[model samples]
Target: MLKLMKLPTAWGLRNASPFNLKAEALLTMSGQAYESIEALPNKGPKGKLPALIDGEQVIGDSSLIQRHLEDKYEARFDDGLSEVELADAVAYRRMAEEWLYFINLWVRWIECPTITRDAFFSGIPWPLRGLVFGRLQKDVKRTLHGQGLGRHTREEIYGFGEEALAAIAARIGSGPFFFGDTPRSVDAALYPQLLNVAEAPYDTPLREAARKHAVLTDYVRRCDQTIFAAREDLPNVA
Candidate 1:
């Protein structure tokens, strides 16, 4: 069985935080049976969530995990994508990983502070909610600053986010999924970022733009139902 080392379920919505969703999607699409290992302070890699453990080996980072899974289960992981399709898929995936990171930070910090705050509070046990909120706020601040997107105020970020979403939506207009016919690696990479934007507690114009796009809304719903079924259990790494 494949053992996924991941964070608590509540943190799953965080942007680069789609590690869990991607891992779950890969597992489900491949029809593989796997166990999950909750990564711990001393036991796992120093960075991020949704690490993978297969037998005695541990893999960290989503992209690396995907590669590892593909190598391990060659037939199952193979999408049989063509060369041009594969190139397009990888390009979009890169955009999702790199560009969406900033978009996510902007949304969480400047754009939807209230929603993030509430989400932070709700994620913790009642007793630790206060402490968790404080830590999360500080952490978010540091992350935003580190990413350089934190320099912009909410309004500025919102403007930028709107343009970004418009561009994405335009690209997506070319087909049902980013790749047209099938859900490719690009769809896997981009979907979660859009999902976070759509579902986040903010009623900003950017989110409104997302809501207006019928294709994006349908894509998100389909990804949620197909790749991330509500009942699927994730690794309980705390």
Candidate 2:
């Protein structure tokens, strides 16, 4: 049996972490079964969620996990696409995981608003949860600062996130998936973040911007229905 380490679930997704969701999506796309369990913040290689263990092989990072699966199975996510198209798919995958991911983090941590903060605090056990959570928040703030989003105003941050969403929406363009017909690895990486922005209970400027795009929201639902519907942790379609 295979196991995945990830965060607690929020909304209807398997996990709140985009990388974890991506790994799960990749696994779903691979037609493989794996179980997910909680991972401490610093567990696994590189201290990240979405690590995978198959027998003695321990792989960390969503991208690394993707590579491992492809190598072990000798399969390709963009199986039917041309070389150029596969290259395009990989490009979008990086944009979603590398660029869009940071923007989503700004809305969650930097904006902190109330719902997200409360959710974070609720994850900690009391007595020490407050102190530990506060320290964690501070560390995240510094990380965002070093990453450059912390320097921007709230509106600026939302605007940046919106731009990334717009690029995604534009690329999708009424297609069933990013590349049309079949979904590539990037679709697996993308669905969770767009779903997060669109369906999160708390109001956010990023959500507002995302809601304006029917295509993107529709795509999220489609992915959820296709890849996530059978899981026990899956939620009702939104």
Q: On residues 144-217, what C-alpha lDDT tens digit does candidate 1 reach at each position?
A: 78877777776776677777677777788856777666665566667877887776656777778788887777
Off by over 4 Å in 1: 10-17, 36-44, 75-82, 122-128, 226-238
Flag clash pairs in model 1. none
**What's the CA error at residue 143 for candidate 1, in Å?**
2.5
RMSD of each: 4.2, 2.9
Q: Report, for every candidate in turn, its global Cα lDDT versus the true structure.
A: 0.66, 0.77
Lowest lDDT sum, 10 consecutive residues, model 2, at 229-238
Mind sharing the TM-score for model 2? 0.90
TM-score on alpha carbons, each prediction:
0.78, 0.90
lDDT of 2 by residue, 1-238 (tens): 6788776676665567777888888877776777777777587877778789888988988888999989997548867778898788778778777667777777776575456657656766776776776677788789888988788887788778889889889999988988887767878888887887788775877888899999999999888777765565432211
